[model samples]
Target chain A: MKSSRGLRLGTTLFSFTNEFHARQYSTEQLILKVAELGLGPGLEIVGFQSFRDYPEISDKFAEDLKELLSSCKLEPSCLAINADINIGKDRTLTVDELVVYHEAQIRAAAKLGFPVARCQFAAGPEVIRRLVPLAERLNVKLGLEIHAPEAVDSPLVLSYREMYVKVNSPYLGFIPDFGASAKALPPSFLAHFRKEGVPEKIVCVAEEVWATAEGNFGARLSEYHRRARQTGAAEADIHKLNMLFAMLSKQKPSAWIEIMPQVVHVHGKFYEFDKDGNEAAISYAELLPVFRDGGYKGFISSEWEGTAFTDDNGFEAVQAHHALCRRILARA
Target chain B: MLQTKLIAENGLRATSTGFDVEVRLPWYRGLPLSTVEIGDVVLNGEAINPASVSIEVNGKTRLPGDLATLYDERWYVLDSAMLHVSHSELKRGEQYDVAVSVNLRPPYIPGLTWAVKDAKRLTANS
Candidate 1:
C-alpha cells in the first residue's frame, strides 16, 4: 500500500499552550524542540494567541519569525485565526465588519509565511465566500475547522462542502479535527468528571446514552435529559451529562472519505498517548488509514490536547503522538 | 480563546461607593498598557462605570482615562493589577456574576481588536 500523495506530519503550537502560558517554554523553544525530536517539518500556529504581538507584527518581527522557523528547520503549515462576531458586549460585528476582521488575519498569515489560514467554526459560508477573493489574491487557503460535536454530515459542514464544490476553488476548504472521529470518550475527560465528584454510575449512563442516542442534536439532547432524570440524577449531575453531547461526536472514521478532497489541513487531536505509542481513546489506527487511502497529501498536525485535563508534559505527549502517527502511516 | 486567572478568593471587595477586584495580565507576555482598555465592568447584573476604574501595575497606579502609558515590562504577570470599580451597591457572601470587558490593540494590524468578555463568579466580601 505504497502512497503517491505527500502526507507530511506537523505539530500545532496549540498543543503547547499550557506550557507557553506557564512560561515553561517559549515559541522558539517549542519550534526548536519540534525539530530536535524529528517531529516532521511542518508547523501550525494560532496567530494572535501564539505570537507575543500578533496581528501587529512589524516587518522586522515577521522576518525574524521566518528566520527562526528556517533555523529550526520547521515549515509554516497554517495560521489558526479567530472570526469573532462579538467584538463587544452589546455589539456584534456586521457581515461587512467580519470580512474586514478576517481579511486582516488572512493578510497576517500570508505575511508570516503560512500557506493556509485556519478559521474557527463561526466563520460561516457567507463570511468564507467574502474571504475567498482575498485568500486567492494572497495565495493562502482558508480552512474552516470541523471540530468535535460537528459531524461531517452537519448542516454547516455540508453547506461549506456545497460552496466549495460550486466555487471549486483551492482558496476555501476544511481542516478536519480528529476529535470528531473519536470512538469513545477520552479517559482523561471521564477522570476529570469523576474527580469533580460525578458518580461513576452517572458517567457510565452518560456514555451509554451518547453511544446509542439517535436523531438530530436537539432530539438527542432531550433524550439524554430524559434518561438522566429517569436515573434520579441530581440537577448538577444532569448538567454535567449534557456537556458530553458537546465534547464528542458519534461519527465513524469512514465518514470522512466523503469530504476528504476538501480537507486542506488535519488536526490530529488526541488526549493521551499510551506507553505503546498509541492514543488511549481515539482510534487513530482506524482513522489514519482512511486518510492515507484517500490520498490526503496535506499535513496532519499533531494537536495534543491532554494538557487541559492532566498535568502531563505537553512536549513529551506531542512527541509520543508523532511517533504513533509515524507507526500508523508506516504500516499503511 | 480569552485566558483569565482569578487572583484572590472572593476577589471582589465591596466599598462604600463601589467594589474593588484584582486581576493579572491574561497571558505571560506583557502587553502595552496604552493598548489595553477596560470598557465595562459588570457585577451581579449591574454595570459599573468604566471611567471610575484605575489600574495598578508595576507599583505605579494610573487611571487610563484616555489610554495613558503605564508599565515598562514586556510581559504580563499572574498578579498584574487591581481594578477599582465604583458601584453604588454590593453585598457580602453573595455570589455575583462578574464580567470584565477588555479590548487589546495589538500592533500588527490596526483597527483589528481582540475583545475579551468573560464571566466568572465572585463572592463579594464585606
Candidate 2:
C-alpha cells in the first residue's frame, strides 16, 4: 500500500564519486543515469564536483541545466556548498570574507533552481547570521549539514539553535546525515581493514570498543589505541582505525527528534546492505520513524558512501537503499 | 584513500625538459592549491630531488614546496596535476617504476591531513 507520508526519496551525485573520478560518467550522464535507474525524482549535487566554474554559473549553463532537469523529470533538491573559511594558508577567512564566498554560491544555487543549499559549519553562527538576509531575499534555505562527529545537541549545533531561536527564520535549518546516528560501524569498513592485514583479534576488539566503549571521543581513541597495541596492531592499522570514530556517529537516533522541525533536508547515508537488504551500519528502521513522527516533509537524499571503501559502482547500493526506505516507510 | 587512482592511466609523457606524470587529486571535491602538499617522486628506486619536482595544473606550474602559499590556484577534482621532474634520464618506450605521495590539509577539517601515495610502473611516451 502506498503510504501518505510527505517524505520523498532521491539521490545525491556524491554517491557516484567513484564513477565520476574514474571518468566513467560526466555530470550530465550521471544525472541521466539517476533518472534511468529510478533513483530520483529529486537530485542533489556538490557544486565543486559537478560544475567546472562553481559559485559562478553562466547563463548558458543555467538554461541547459533547467532544460536537462525538465526533460529528465527531476527536481533540484539541494546544492551542497562549501564554506571554505580556511581557504587562506596563513589565516582563516574573516566573517565578512566568508559571507562573500558563501553569497556567490548561494546565488548560484538560486539561479540553478535548488530550493536548499547544504552548508558546512566551518563558519560560525556569525557568518550564518550575516548570510540570513541574502538567503531570505533569494528564498533559498541554508541547511548546515550535521554530519558525523556532530549531532543535534553538539555544542556547535546548539549555538546555531540559539541563533535560530533569536532569528526565528524558516530559511535557517539543519540537514542531518544519518551517519551521525549510526548503530554500528559499517561492516564493509571493518572488512576492508582486515583485508589490508589488520588482525582479526584486533578487528573484534575494535568492534567491541565501538559498540560498548564509554567516554568522549578523545578518551575512547586513547583506549582503542591502548587495546589495539596490546594485540600487536601496526601503527598504520591503528591510524586507519581512527576513521571509525570520525565517520561513524555514536549519537542515538532518537536524538534527531530535538531538531526535526528545523531539518530542511536529510542525507540518507548508507555504506552497505546486508543479505536481508537492511543497512549494515545505520539503522534506518530506527531513523525513518523519527522523521515520520516529527512531521519532516523533505527529501531524503540517498547518499551511498560504499564506494569509499570498495570499488563498487554504487548504482545497486543506491537502489537497495531506496528499496529499504520504501519498505520501511510503507509501514510507517 | 583512493591511492591507486592518484596516478592517471597511460599519463606518462616525455617533456622537453624531462618527463611528466599525471597525478590526480584523490578527494571527491576540488580544493585550493594552498591546501595541497606534493611530496616525493621516486623513479626506479631513486628518489628525485625535491627541488626538481614541479606540479603543473590549470595552465600554471609551481614547484612542490611553493604550492603551500598559492591560495588562488585550484585543482579541479576531475583534473590531474602533472608532476614534472627535470631529469634527462627518462627515455621513451621504457618501463619505469614511479612513486608519488601527496598530502591534503582541508581547512574545514582541522587537525587532519590525509596522505595518499601511489606507485605505478608504466612506459614513458615521448
Candidate 3:
C-alpha cells in the first residue's frame, strides 16, 4: 500500500500574497522562525520584493538559506515566481524569458533541497511544454496554479492535461489550490442551510462581500473582517460567525481534488479547530478517507487564514496549526 | 510617481542610429498586439518621444532633458542593464492606449532593475 506521505502545516509569511507591505515579516524571520517552531515539513520561500531583488535571484542568499535549512532540517516547500505584470512598462513574458526566470527558481530550489518550483500565472500549456524539458534537465515541477473563476473542467484544465497527455511528460504539472475549488459556489446556493430563516444580519456582511470580489466565499472568511469597520459590525468572532453559517450552508462536499496528481504542495487552509484539533468548516473525517482511498500522497502545509491571529499572535496561530496539522497527517 | 502610457499600434522597429515614435489605441480598442510596438534596448534606451522631450535610461537614472541630436533615437543598453516598463498607464480605469518608442519591449523584460548603494532612514530632514 502506498501510504500517504503528506507533509503538513507550514506558513507562507501570510503577508506576502495577501498584501503589498509584505516585509513586515522578513525572509530570515519566516525561515528561522518556522524552524524554531519545528514546523519544518517544508518552507515555501518567496524570491521577490520581500526577500530578493528582480531579474536576478541572489546567489549568496541562496547559499545562506541552504545552510539554515540544513541545520534546521527543513526542505523547501516551493519558490514563487515573481511577475510584476501590471500596466505602464512591458509585463508580458516570452517562453525563452520565462525559461530564464524558471532557471533562477530551479537553481534556488536545488540549493535549498527542493524538487518543485511553483509559479503563479503560468501563461499556457505551450509554456509548460517549453518548461518540461528544462524541468527534466533540472529535475523539478514547473507548476502552474489552477485558481478560482476557473475550474477543473475549464479550458485551462484541458490545456494542461492535454499537454501532459500529448507530450506525456511528468516535469509539468499543477498546484491545485484548495481555495480555488472552494470558490466554486452558486449565489443562491446558501438557501439550504440548517440554520435557515435565522437573522439575515449574521451573514449579511459576508454576502455583500462575495458579490464583488472572488466568489469562493468558503476560502475568504478573513476578508469580511477587513471591511467590517466600514460595515458597522467589526468586532470579536465576527468573521467566523459568518463562516460557520456559510459552511453548514453547503449542499454538497464539492469537487475539490480534480487537479490533484499535478499538485506538488497544498495550502492546508482552515478557519476553526475542535477540542480534538480538527478543522471546523471542512469535513476531514470524510476528506482524509478520500485521499487514502485515492492513493493521494504528498505535501499538505497549513495556511491558517482568517483575522483571528492579528500581527501579535501570528506566531502562536502558526504553531497551533502546525501541531494540529501534524497530528492529522500522522494519522493518515 | 507620475506615469504615462502610449502604444505603437501598427508596428515598431528601430535601428542603432534611427527610431520612430507613434501612439495608437490599446488592444481593448480592438486593435492588434502586433501593431503595438514598445521600444526596448537590452540594457537601456534613449527616446525622443515628443518633439522636444528626451527620456534616457543609461543604466542609471531616468534622465529627462531637452532633445539634442540623433543619439535621441538610439538606445543604449549596458551588458546587464535592461530597461523595461513594469506596467502601462491605465488612465482613470480604461485599459487601452498605444505608445511609441524603441523603449518598449514585449512584456518579456523589465525596464530597469537596481540596487540601493547606501539606503538608510533619515533621523530628520536636513
Best by DockQ: 2
Q: Kindly list the per-residue Cα lDDT of model 2 for residues A1-332, writing each as its tens digit.
A: 24727789999999999999888899999999999999988899999888989978999999999899989999999999987877745757788888998999999999999999998878789888889999999999999999887878878789999999999999999999998888899988998988978788878888888888876677777788889899887888777788788787778998988888999999999998889999988999889988887898989999988877788877888999989998999993
* Best by the lDDT measure: 2
Q: A1-332 in candidate 1: lDDT tens per residue? A: 14425778889888876677665677778788778887758899887556766666789988988999898888999998876554433345678888887888898998999999998766678888888889999999998888867888888688888888888898887888888887777777888879868877778877887778877567777877887778786977777656567656768999999888888999999988556778877899999889888878889899987754566677788888887887777773
Taking all chains together, each candidate's TM-score versus the true structure is 0.77, 0.96, 0.55
Which scores higher on lDDT, 1 or 2? 2
Please compute DockQ, using alpha carbons, for every candidate against the native two-chain complex.
0.09, 0.65, 0.03
Better of 2 and 3 by TM-score: 2
Per-residue error for B58 in candidate 2, Å, reads 0.5
| TM-score of model 2 (CA atoms) | 0.96
Query: How badly does each model clash, as a count of residue pairs?
Result: 10, 0, 28
lDDT of every predicted structure (CA atoms): 0.74, 0.87, 0.45
lDDT of 1: 0.74
